[model samples]
Target: MLLALAVVPAVVQEAVLVGIGFHGARGLAPQVTAVWPYDSYHDLRWLLIYHNSWWHFLFGLVALAVFRGLLSAGLTALAWPGQVPRPSFAWLLRRNLEVAALALVVISPWAALSVAFSAVALSLYLFASLIPMLVLAPFLQRAGVARTWWRGLPTIELLGWSVLNFAVLTIAGAVISSTSGWWGVLVAALAGVANGLLWRQTVTAAVLPARIRLARVPVAPVAIILTMAAAVAAQPILNLVTGPPQEWMPLVVTERLPDRVPHAVIVIAGHDSHWSGRQPADPRVERFSYQGLDRQGRPLPYRHTATHRSLDSSSVLLRAQVEALHRRTGRPVALIGSSEGAMVARTYLEKGPKPSPVEAVLLFSPLIQPGRAYYPPPGYSGWGVATGWELRGLFWLVGLGRADRSRPDEPFVRSVLVNAPFYRNRTLCPVAGVRMIAFLPTVSAAEAPPGEYSRIPVFQLPAFHGGLIGRRAAEERVVDFLAGGHVDQPRREYALLQRLGAAWQAPPLALVLNPVWAAEREADPAFTGRICEPR
Candidate 1:
């Protein structure tokens, strides 16, 4: 009921806003739910939250507060009990509000990024994972719930329960979005209650915590842990037996635009997208963002193929394309690579023939320098990296040592493993006129050394797993950069929502994780926040 009090009001407000945004589209629930948290944030951010109309903007501000601030305070209030003669309601409300506010200092950065991802799943996880520090900031609370970390139960929680909770609630939100009218209201309420129960059980460990306490010998914990372990280990084994669906999207070039443009963009795609990839045969400016850039550099088409004999071979193909494009156009070329494709782009730039004709490069989610993935507990970052390591061990343990990464690895892990690293770091040689930048997600790793990205702007977006390309904000900035517009990355975040605990354009993860990003390492002279287009 308390959780409902927190979740339902905002949800209702969101429903109205969705209705308004839908602009009389039929099936409010279906329209709202069709794209989900991705489109949810996009519409809210662009159309509503930052709408041109004054009243719409004001309403968006209030709605944002109701959605985030209220939820935080409510979660804090709920988790705040268990202390002696629990404080009075008035005092409880005030004090918990204070705690939620302080936690906001921490949450804002992450929240901004979550909004950036456009996926509520990550946002929910961000809140669930960290709010436990605030005792019931909604979803899983580690300090209170997972008391069996010493006995290796935390591994299960981190690898299993937390993921489950994040995924389920995300789906639940979608379910709620899918209902409307009076019947839909009831359905939404019921869905809200169901989610509340799950959140309560997860946040408080209602079911397992009690059993854990009663069974002093960890019998319950062990049994539960083993079951979860088997479940986790089972899926991959099944996949190994029954390989994943692989439907590769081939590059189709039918001469839609002039091929001899001034700047040709070449994109090197990451691992199997289920393998979805599309290359604009004859784009006006050679890439998505460079459509208007008749003079600026253009990136190569994003390329993905399972047929590459090796990473080196992939880079060779990139060089061949780069040379071929430059020869035809007699113009400079830019390289845009994502995931393993980013590594392939990096290799060509670093080791290709000297006096490199490639004048600009944009690496999306590259793995040029992945930090140590497997460290001890409180392992803050590197879940993506950790998964790769875990998979290697799991496959080896299951007697599949030779399992090819082509099928075995997730995109994140494969990126890290692809450019494993040299005995030592390579010296960077950044060109004076050339514009080189990397659009990074939440994870650390500069993708290049201090000097390599010394001049160009390195964007820290809220995207991951090849999601940067999908974000509107990222696309806008990328278009500007590709078009040769001077990029001015933001140094500090827009502070309008500091009091309300809102996060804007800055990377929320950098506040604690990446000091390099937080410091805005080596931004150019033309740096400007994308919060608004200030003349």
Candidate 2:
């Protein structure tokens, strides 16, 4: 019954979205022809607001309330067995409407901010609003509970669970809405079922019943499996529909010289949803091959659309491609990797069965230990610190699988960081022969211990993470390095370190008291640096 009720809203929403050409066929089908919708947050938001009516939004809110009420009531009945009476549809509907009304009221202020400010502001407001709701919603529900329930309520656990649940639902909804045809409908139905089960379990835990004991359903596994399956299925199809993957293929912008030069440059793009490699217009190197396939073997069209699977597979593929290029051209390769691509290059060189044809490997803002690399240090104080952390947390939650279908690189990157040791252990092939050079930003350089690996030479660049890829001086250094020439003047920027020392630390309550501080950090020179380097 709970599943049936939950599915109604999902089916209705899908139908309505499709009918209005907002979700299926005419809408997502056309947009996702060349790219997946995982990273298209702004576009998706605009579509929802522009294509959908106020009635549609209202209906969705009401449906959400009804579903929550029914699920909670059903779970309560099951848990108490003989003690609690089964709620009638009308009673459940009434309770749900009341709960929904309260929720809408709480969220309406944040929602109204959408009119005055950007969606980003509204999103931050919405996230801020959810913290209180997570803590209070269980208590607010009319479901019979002991007076002492509030005293024993697990606030932290409930908040974490709510965050996880929200992540799952949001990802599921995004996938469903972005997909077209019967496939979208089918995925939406599965998501609805999963949502119902998750809600039932969450309610069961929140409102602990005194009498009857019911066996716990494996909600996490079920949701994970459902989400993973949907993500994997959605990714490749979206890629195929968006257009030919050739547009994303590695382009040989400059023709190779008739005489085979000993060294060739192979550039691997960082964690982006598009073909992001920028070939140097240098005439010294004959050929340049940009990495075409993202970690998931799909064409990268923009940021956040590609899916990421095992780095091992991608590494193997990279090795094969590099080897083929080397064999055909009869030239030794010099690999230049940025961000996640740098990690892939390292993996390939360290783990591949065949020895790398490359003589030199250059890593720009390479993420070797993701946990350490991406983490904000204790003394760091920036405007967007809290927001950045929250966004990172959300990405981590959404990307918890073999493939990050919705937000491709984030989870995979996190997995790589967490499993760095595992990959390191698999480094049976020696990299002593490869002259690896690492160009790290000041902030990242602080985290990375220099000379950890004797063979790889780590240089501290006076730039931000994104800046390393775009700076002309950095690019020239890369070109020189590929040509087996050394960087003349390597300098460290201690400005970030000095600023970290001088800036006042944000209080723990700052997240609630002044959430704007998170955004402020982004603009702060102390956190991001004073240098205006392009990415």
Candidate 3:
């Protein structure tokens, strides 16, 4: 309840502000501006300020319970004359000193959210909460009523839950223009409680028996240690089996825009974590920024102004390229985007004068939104989008592992790729009727907002092993764009499908510029020198 009292007000405040921003703003533009300025800070601060309140409250309640036990023993000693010498207060004090220290290590940072911590604090808060739930589950299960109650636990008793709800609604409101505030809050609350209970069970079952007194020559301490280690191991294993979901990460540049006009294509490189790599990858630049380098130069600590991948610096670099293209070629240039490069293209277009300055856009398995997926379906008929797993693999190949479980303090490497200085000075994209020729493994019209996108012609490519098998998609899309051929899907699909089915599916289609060769080294080092030539 104390946790609720402390956390709810802040949450309510943020959510209310977000709702006002949503409803009160003149339209999308002002709301977008307001949402970023206040909602983000408010959401983050809310997390930091209130993460530990419930844990603190729990500590007090437990300490009180221990005190009650000790006090009862003392009173019994006076009445019964002999009984167990009322266990020494000095001994109790000394033992509890260790307990208090441990508790502080566990709870204080949570309560204070000290040190401007991020994922770690949240993890600890979760860990401390989970321990007791597991220990008590059997009892609750036996109680039947308690088990049912726990499953659909009510909001009022849970600590910091309401606060979590409010924070989620505000943030969601900030990002998605049409989210329902009350529904968002309700979903957040339910999710938080359910997750909290799950965490509590996992942690308490692992720890308390070890740290506290245990009967029968217990090895609970060692067991607890092993449990924690196993939990850590479980994470990577889970990622592998479940095929870690795609997440947004920093964008990187593969090549610079041509100084001359009518450039053939804009190549943007994808990134990867290189967990298996030994040496660090060298840095390169694709944008103009605070650090002031147009080509590969050192970076500053400053963050990008727009989305993490859409860097101001890189956008500036692209803006310069765009201006030069119009001047030199006497005709607007065409853009070729791949992977995270698509975001660079999108941001460039968002700055306006695109499709005009650049007549058309050609994307190859583009990372339109960082880490989110565009999936392909179960059968050939289902071939309209790329599945979540393929995109995750694509990122892993680029050395920019999964975004969902990202380390909070990670520097914005991908973000730097698109951070062009010029983009900051420009307005967001409002250009109309510029052609967007999208070459995707699957182009799902369903995933797109009904009318959010304009005049974008998507070309669906063939799939193999439930994924985009080769360059057929890219080739056809480019060929059509350059040739000015209207897409004839029924005829094209029949021919492609027939050829793929014949000759035992024939040889794999070749690519003009295969991203796979670059991704190969990071994916598996044994072939690094063989395929990538050890660069």
Candidate 4:
């Protein structure tokens, strides 16, 4: 019943939001209806990455406060004794708004910071899962949520939900996850429902009568996985009717790279990793340099810096190398880049002059933002009706020489964050003709999933930043994708991510099955034109 209650409102919420054309902001919806563990943190994350417009985002927040807030409070009131006086609407609204504001201002950033650091990623996920049960449940219970499966059992804390979650995570989470295309959303939601079932003793005693009771404890796992499988299998056929996800890309990873795969490719190393090291044995693959260094790995007068000029410099070298390789092999060059080098590859595709050279790009955890480890998008979204002023503001920022010009990665922090079209264009529209896939570190995204907000088909790896650079599996998957062969995800590592409280599911189901995919695209733009355009 608790789980069903959560799902029921989610359908209504998603429908109303989409019916009004705000699917981009749907990330703000509970991962699985109302059983969401972290409310404030997720709400803010969706607003920045998946929002349609500031108005839409704000409207969603208000709706969350009014509808969810009022409903939750009403339920709490009803759960208490009949003699108790119900809280007034004004009081409920004020309390909900306060909690929402507090989350947006204080708690959200702190949670984001905890996830950004790799060492703390798993701990953060645990804390996130616990927030709903340990913190919110108790608070509401104390505030008169009289009935819960909360009886104090004998050492059940040591033997119950923790063990159950751990077992489910180890045996099923990731493997079952792939079965359903909607793994990210549905499993996340169901797991959310399961999170509250930790009170085995109390739940068994009370819930056996009221509803699904503890059956959901075992049943949810089966439902989530089977549902995901059906969705994934059905998606390709459905796409025939709806058309391909033009802007969205779907990809997977592996464990090893075949040594003798016959493909023409170029390898771009991350910051400071140049041709000085032992080169790859395969003659089909060549490594390029952007630090103005000689082919023998000697440094030149110019050094790489965090400016647009460095991007132009490396992009020019990339063009020359791709053209050379293409001519030699009589085939298009496939780009494989790691870290900062991946950003260089991204810049070339986005801003490098027409007629893209590379046919396929495999980027290992590219830096999407310039300055900060994580930077949320500014509000407003688009230029409303007048798109021309978008270009004018960009020109004014560029012509006025306003970039900080740091000396680390490719672009200055201000360039991307301050609307200079740093990595992605400030206007944030999709460009044509380049097949690109990004492999992201699961640890980095364990808590705050930056890739979820990206338009690129981001493949989650069990490895950390720079972890997938030479992995044979990733290399093999890249080869398979380039050759149009079968591509699938790694088997075991995904469970590690799931154990840490994230749904390490693949992306295709949402792209195909979810009707609000276009809104998701809008929500996940690089940057928007809200600054000078009055969106």
Candidate 5:
């Protein structure tokens, strides 16, 4: 009864949200009922990701009630077969009816909403079967019931009812999810139903009910595979119908140096969602410099920072822009790329239509080794993993799987691979052939191999995510790299750097090839130099 009570309101709420609330958002004409803005709003994504797990608990409770009711009624009828145990029968029937009714309530507005709600409801019901009988002692006992069965009946009914209600709510929730529009409601429902069936359990007891012991169900590996396939396929299709997100881009330029100079620099933005959020206020972007000229014919320090949204796909576009700028400005250009942007610069050098006027390249903490290590793998469970269990649950809810996973084992021998282009495939960059001066953080002897570090000159920085580069002396070293001269003589920590730079006039393909403080050694050949040392 308690579960039923919960279900009834949830179903009603879901129905109202889906049927009336959603249409109002679209300004559609009035139907049998109309909802205000707030009434129509639903958080279906939350329902899909979070509520499904909750429903698992709730459904376990309901399933327990159903199985228990069947047993109690059976035992009583056999003991005294003349009477129908009308009270118990009525309660069981009402619980089922209430849940079913709630499902309908949520489904009335949209089928997809119903499916999502139903899946969550079913998952919850199944999960509830795990709860111990002792925990439900209070709910089992109700007013006007002398027998122990009556005590458990209401709570069981309530559990069942709650499942039904949540199902309805799920439907409504799916309808209102930002990922779903009116059409997605319908598509998602079918997907949700199919996805939900994958985890269906026959037993109803927290301790494993005896009722379903004799039953047989189909289980084929092919079916499981197909279910996985269907779930994966449904999500992108639903998202497409709902709406493709609009990509955003923001650009900021800072030129605070002498004016009217002919100096120039070209920058290729990195590939990460975090890249877009970087702005002038950020010290990282602020400290990062581009070569530009002042009015007095001296080199000017300038910075053009790309917002995070633009960082994802702007690299190839920026490479082309650099070509255009080169034609227009006729200035010597230096190229700076961070992370994935380093790859973009390289690609532009190799494959872009126009010749790159950029003289040099600088890479910071590049994700050069692609494949599984590129991004942290999704966690097996919810917490502690980079991508948690909730996201996996979401994929299940939306009928999605690993179709979008990337393959990085392929060779990079050719400029253009036959199978996929990085720009079209990864949706990042299309440019190729740029040389790079790569700097990576400290790596273990076991992790570093000749193949990974062979051709490229490597500068090992301290800490994760390039902590060494953030140092002021390191920044000056970078400034010197741009200035086209290496550190000259022997010094304390930079003795190796000075020797390498002074011995070799041509810049190495990789930065930090000589040593981390090589440029500083060139700046001060004497033993007294202490610019790079911490005070």
Candidate 6:
């Protein structure tokens, strides 16, 4: 009954906002049409009036606060039951108004911030919000159902529960909205029901007796750890029995020469599924597959297993195959890898006890990073903050040799690869002797060591990630380099390379994207910064 009453105001406010928005749209249409002759004016008016209207912001904030308060009260009542008495209609209204005012004052200031700045705001808000809860948890339990005043409220616990509920609901809504048709609605409805049951279970657990709670405390973590271990232990058996899917099989293109020693190019594909089973079809260059397959000959997708272990195993297998091929055909081998594959190749070279059979190594779109700060892209700044926590959780799972197959697109593997400090250490850069060439696209160019190393040549490509994979010009350059020829292009044209020559060194990961660099440059005319300067 209390939940129903709380929801009534929210429903009414939503309906009123829809009506107002529709009326505003109708009134603005004529003005939009009148300004259509001037494209710039029309765009400006549309952006200002339709997209960034103050009225919309006000209405949205009120609606969000009302819904949040309603959900908060409902969950609190559910959790504490007899202890948390049902709020009166007047009490509910007061609480909603308080929440709405807080949202407007505290959150609205940071709403206009950029993605990265907004992430900072979100972290601050989450931390600030949790403090009150941690402090009030004991007080709320002590208060029981004694008073109906604001001073006696369990605002922190209520807000925390509501936030979790909101997250589940939001995810369901997103899935529904992103889907094509009525199936989405059905799925969302089922999700909603499941979420409600889950919420009930969560509340029950929260209110469990002291003895029961203590007894179950260690069970969950232990179970999770054990399950992950079992999964990792079982992977080899699964791989052997299932066989690699056909797509996972190495794609080999052979080039045989009559008299001279044949030259072999071993290509290691990246994380992208599109590159699976891809091979260079050049007659002069033989392409050998380094990625492993299951027993059934089906491809084991990169995301299907614990990547670090799988890649390590695959790297070992690759060396054995290359050695056998070198023995039989007397071929000189060249290793070429892209993205995650590049990281794997680098790992093999670094960890191997002896020098590999490969005569040269060419890395494209390598995943080497100085630290965690450089992992996320510009667009990932905001949501990446939250996803970082998820990555931490999955990192342990992967460390235990368990694969998180549920979310293939999640940057868990990338997170692991980027944070591996050994790979980023300049002192441990692949041992000398072998010819090494790094062809890095703009985004990943920072991964390469600054300046020229003895046998390592870092070439910057004026393109984004994955741009050099199949391009004819890029492929030709790679082939030429592998054949003991240097890249003919002017190296000075690349901004990153030029900066390296000008004493612009790669900064630590935390400072790489620091806004202070921009601020310092803006403040001083001749301030040449280490980070974010030209490069």
- Overall lDDT per candidate, in order of appearance: 0.39, 0.41, 0.31, 0.41, 0.30, 0.39
Candidate 5 local accuracy as lDDT?
A: 0.30
- Those runs of model 4 whose alpha carbons end farther than 4 Å from true positions after fitting are 1-9, 17-37, 41-69, 81-101, 110-265, 270-286, 293-314, 321-334, 339-466, 470-535
Q: Write the per-residue lDDT of candidate 5 for residues 196-254, one digit (tens) a residue.
A: 22112101211122232212332222333443344335446645875643211212123
In candidate 6, position 406 carries an lDDT of 25
* Native-to-model Cα distance after best TM-score fit, residue 206 in candidate 2, in Å: 36
Top of the candidates by TM-score: 4
What TM-score does model 6 achieve against the real structure? Answer: 0.39
lDDT of 3 by residue, 154-230 (tens): 22222233233334333433332233344434433333333333323322322222222223333333443443343
Per-residue accuracy of model 1 over 1-535 as CA lDDT, tens digit each: 5555634653574466444332111112221211112212222333221232345545654554334344433543464435323334555345434433333333332233222222111222223222322222221233223333223222333224344433444444334323344443454455445445444444444223433333335443344344334423543555587576343221212234233324666655565432233446555223221111123333323323343335556666666667766876777887777665666676676568778778887777654323212111122333222222333344354444434433324333333333322100221224445677767664322112111222346676544445677666776666667667666553232111111111111111111232322332322111111111211
Local lDDT at 86 for model 5: 34
Off by over 4 Å in 5: 1-263, 273-315, 372-435, 443-450, 486-535
Ranking by TM-score: 4, 1, 6, 2, 3, 5
The TM-scores, one per candidate, come to 0.40, 0.37, 0.34, 0.45, 0.30, 0.39
TM-score between model 3 and native: 0.34
Tens-place lDDT per residue, model 4, 314-418, is 777777667667667776667777765676677677666578557777777665332212222233243111111222332243334535322212243223332
Instruction: Give the per-residue lDDT of model 2 (tens digit) for 291-376.
Output: 34455333233333442544666676677667665665677877767665676777777677555687778776664222211222
